[model samples]
Target: MSRPLDKAGWQAMADTLTARLETRAYIDDRFVDAAGGETFETINPATGEVLARVASCDQADAELAVAHARRAFDGGEWSRLAPTRRKRVLLRLAELMEAHRDELALLDTLDMGKPITSALGDMAGAIGAMRHQAESIDKLYGEVAPTGEEALALVLREPIGVVASIVPWNFPMMMTAWKIAPALAAGNSVILKPSEKSPLSALRLAALAQEAGLPRGVLQVLPGFGHTVGKALALSMDVDCLAFTGSTAVGKQLMQYAGQSNLKRVYLECGGKSPNLVFADCRNLAQVAHHAAEAIFHNQGEVCIAGSRLLVENSVREAFIEHLLAAAESMQPGDPLDPSSFMGAIVDATQHRRILDFIRQGQEEGGRLRAGGEALDGPGLFIQPTVFDGVTEDMTIGREEIFGPVLSVFGFDSEEQAIALANDSVYGLAAGVWSQDVDRIMRVSRRLQSGQVFVNNWAGGDQSVPFGGVKQSGNGRDKSHHSLAEYTELKSVWIALN
Candidate 1:
């Protein structure tokens, strides 16, 4: 069913919306200035307008946040809080988020220029994930090993020290909650560094967290650039673990920083050039095509798991391509504030131009554009949902992640060839299978070298499933019980009896 775009609902959002949010870097549950008196422009890509003058947090602000987090974790006020108490605090935070969701989501759209619809989903997903963690917080436990004769071995699940969670611009609020909820539930104090492009929600959340009765410094948000606050979090000796979601290049730098600084646990959810494989055995090619368009078109294809590369069998290639183009043509890139808008603006002008550069390069490299290949003329940074046919494997558009509403189509003759083509990319983040045959689903899921594989649908996760990729896609899991372990340490206790 289509979501209702009612006038009342639209009017409510319009009245609440603002181009800028009043916030500051959160330290010890209080808003403060960056020691460095610097600032940056947070722009609205939907209209290329400056939304807010955000603090340019430098090394000093980073140090302050880390110190506060270290104090909170080491003080044991938060880390030693009983699981039920932690759960109560989490539940309270969830309620607060719901209460202010419209405000938070609207501020996010204004700053990042994501559609209000997308922002609402971000807010809902963040609240849902927090509730999920609240319910499961009590399930945490340590395991007792079986004894042969002498004694028993107890494996205690203990909270690690201060944690640094760095989120990307896309889905900032949801990603922030994804890391914080599990890490906090596992009994660790956290320092959050949201992307400067969209840090308003993170700061706003920090205030709500304080109101939720979370002890001072239990959760801190540092609104700053990657070179300063982000780098400090990654390189701080006091930070026991670091979590990040961004490009592979930054992920690699985090890996190196972890090794160089404290050898801290680095959890990363990086980029992708995932395959959405369409076998000839599929009956509904049109439905499959429409869903594929949705996969890339959603969030302007800023999703880490966008099915960017479409692998179609040669037999039904032409018909599927026709349907895919039709789906793209139907999409409208209107104002992000409008509730009726589907495709929204790119997150920022840099990203807008980056996606456009890739499109132009795709054309120059002989890839055929069946749909869109240019940015629409207007005040907003809007690009039409794009599709390229006859894309060679070597082309930059096919191999590298464009991270926009762009899809590369390559036809395959046999099952072996399809698998080979899908696995050819350096990234193994996510993939989808569209086939009626169960055997094909089983075969492809096993052979596909991705962290998550979606069969007959686009969704591929629950809160329990580990959500990290292999190879260049970055390491460590985000969701599931496994994710909680990333922010914890296991201490071995042995008794000496003589």
Candidate 2:
């Protein structure tokens, strides 16, 4: 279908989808009920309506899915397929996803409360990532190591079997693609445990994968609470590797579970308290302020690499705040299905309450509320774009990952102080530097402890480069050839020549 022209058009399409939503776990090339036949309600955060009662999978389901995945991996049906053959499968899957772009976008919007427009962008990103990884399958070359004249050596990259990808509710389709695309392209059987809050798109994607010529038992989708399905995947001896994108606390738990289990490899892309610095030397304060608001308010601030902290040089602090407040005014939360709505509802009531609590804590801790710090009057879980000025490095809102549409503004007298404030947090997933001075941008960008740094920009990068973080933001990269390495093992071979 073409892009919906108006809110009514989108809502009508969403109503059509609601009547026949997929609600079962997809395993072994089919949809089935949970082992215990239990179910859980997935709420539409925008209107507080139950979209579906999806299969509430648990440890038993995880075990079943893993067993299927292991069987498929060892059977040489997909794992031993030629790289070009795997490439064709992935390319076909991408085509299928493109064909159903509107449905997938609506599913994520209805499930997780992201704006329809943003969800469409996510579909494009997901499809692009799939195609990129597919094309890379045959292009990635193994190495022929140098040796003496009497000997020959070869190094090969082999797929790690049975990858479990546990993704977050925010940006569900894109995050799922980031993990499963690379793993599947690397010839691994994948058991995907999408967050229960947003599993419709993933469950639907599994069927498309099967239709795209993926072998039976090669791809499975199990949706449930983290304590059950997630824990099981992390602790499963049959699972060769686990890749996750979520909170730091959960990432640490998975690490501990890895140690307690069969020592499977774990790759995490977790939480962030990213800092955005605006030096006075920046040529365009107005543009910087607009992007600064977008960095935190877009997607209702559910981004893992959201620039939650804004550090400004004292010289232009007041001027920047004026432009930033104006930008925030244009980003008020609205119905997610509305194409004009840039910001949508919070993911759920629990997250809504957590964001409110942090806002309250920010006031209690003496940070001045410069702009909206209250919830919008609506049936949905929506909050105004909140900005806290006078934030110090010691403030709770400044140090912690709020993961909401909240921006903490801090002022620094010197470049040294700005760098110090930016690096003062336990999380360092991403950061932004705004400066026209080439030397200063170079200096600050190198000194900041972050996985990705955007200079004169905010949150700008593509799948060609790696996406990940250091410190508590979690280790391991995603979305590039580096991500493919995570799902593969290196094998070195030496041959004697007569």
1-498 in candidate 2: lDDT tens per residue?
454558999999998989998899998999999999999999999999999999999999999999999999999999999999999999999999999999999999999999999999999999999999999888888899989999899999999999999999999999999999999999999999999899999999998998999999999999999999999999999999999999999999999999999999999999999999999999888888999999999999999999999999999999999999999999999999999999999999999999999999999999999999999887899999999999988889998888899999999999999999999988889999999899998899999999999988887888899999999999989988989878889999999999
Clashes of each: 1, 0
Question: What are the TM-scores, per candidate, against the unseen true structure?
Answer: 0.96, 0.99
- Residue 446 shift from truth in candidate 1, angstroms: 0.1
Candidate 2, superposed: residue stretches over 4 Å from native: 1-4
Off by over 4 Å in 1: 1-20, 496-498
lDDT for each residue of candidate 1 in 1-498, tens digit (9 for 90 to 100): 446555366546545554336557888878887778778888878877776777778778878888888888889888998889899999999999999887778777777767788889889888977888877778878787766566667888788878899999888888998999989988898988889999888888888899999999889888888887888888888889898999999999988999999999888899999999999898788988888888888888999999999999999999999999998887757687787777788887788889999999999999998888788898888999999999989899999999899999999999899999999989999999989999889998999999989998885566767788987898878777777777778876655333
The true-structure Cα RMSD of candidate 2 reads 0.9
lDDT of 1 at 32: 80
- RMSD in Å for model 1: 2.1
